[model samples]
Target: EAEVAQSPRYKITEKSQAVAFWCDPISGHATLYWYRQILGQGPELLVQFQDESVVDDSQLPKDRFSAERLKGVDSTLKIQPAELGDSAMYLCASSHRDRGPMNTEAFFGQGTRLTVV
Candidate 1:
């Protein structure tokens, strides 16, 4: 099966530095999601997009984080002024459909682990 693509499996940076991650969802997928997983906690949706349109981003920290899905396919997430608390696993997920909570598998990437010191 074709898989979602993510870059820089690991990232190490100093506080206040800038960091970015990239992801490419599976072909034909209509919905893409970015999540942040802290330690043992479940992932929290940072942003969600449906064919280049923002579906929900209430939890996204707009001050320092920004994301875009140009062309409605590949997406990128960037963080400026990184904080120590920002250290966590950044995951990218994609689904074929988002209209219903039906039984559909959400494919996740290996995730980009960011470490801020």
Candidate 2:
């Protein structure tokens, strides 16, 4: 079996700097999402893409965060001028929506942990 997602896994950067992470999702998954997990909370949806089209990003900080899944393959998430509050685990997940409820398990990445110094 192939790995569902691949990324650098860790990142540490100074405040006000820019950082980016990438995730390579499962081959046939059409719904992709980027989630941020804080210290003791469950992952929060930052952005969601349905085949290269953004479905929702209401929680994403548009001023400093951006996400894209152009071409509907791999995806990227970027943060500029990162703040201390931005330190968290960024998890990428993808699921093939065509599959029915029972089989539509979301495959997740081993997340990129970001620490803003």
Candidate 3:
């Protein structure tokens, strides 16, 4: 079975520092997504990418956060001047089809946990 891969399972950074996380979605999956999960809340979509182009990023904080999937296969998410509120789990997911009722399943990575101090 194929699975999404993420680097640096854990991260700790200062409030004003910058942090970045990497993810490699399953091969052949055309849709990729980045999500943020606060401790007790459900995952929130930050960005969605189809191939090398962005499909949606309405929830991503353009001022301090950015996500890119240049080659359309792997991606990176970065946060500058990290804030305590930014501490959470960053998850990457992929699906073979576009987001819709037909595409009910998505494979997700273990996620990268960020902690800001």
Candidate 4:
């Protein structure tokens, strides 16, 4: 089976340092999403992409976070000057449709767990 790709399954950084994570969605998927999950909370939507265009990023902390899907295939999420509160699992998911719930099989990556001290 094809897989959504992610790397650096774990990271440790001092507070205020920049960090980045990468992902590659399943082939042919048109919609992609990035989520952040604190230890016990459900994943929070950080950004969504339709092809190469951004569809939503309202929950992303703009001052410290940014993401892009330049080729509409792979993507990256970056945190500049990360903070302790930024410690969490960063998951990357992809789906077939950009809207509606019909194609909600959002495959997830192992996640990049960031730890900021």
Top lDDT model: 1
Candidate 4: TM-score? Answer: 0.94
Models 1 onward score TM values of 0.95, 0.94, 0.94, 0.94
lDDT of 4 by residue, 1-117 (tens): 999999889999999899999999999999999999999899999999999999999998999999999999999999999998999999999989845656568999899999999
Residue-by-residue lDDT tens digits, candidate 1, 21-94: 99999999999999999999999999999989989999999999999998999999999999999999999999
Report the C-alpha lDDT of model 2 over 21-101, residue by residue, as the tens digit: 999988978989899999899999999999999999999999999999989989999999899999999999998876555
What lDDT would candidate 1 get against the real structure?
0.94
Candidate 3 residues lying further than 4 Å off, grouped into runs, are 99-104
lDDT of each: 0.94, 0.91, 0.93, 0.93
Residue 33 miss distance in model 4 (angstroms): 0.5
Per-residue alpha-carbon lDDT of model 3 for 4-113, expressed as tens digits? Answer: 99988999999989999999999999889999999999999999999989999999999999999999999999999799999999999998865566754789999999
Model 3 score (lDDT): 0.93
Better of 1 and 2 by lDDT: 1
TM-score of structure candidate 2: 0.94
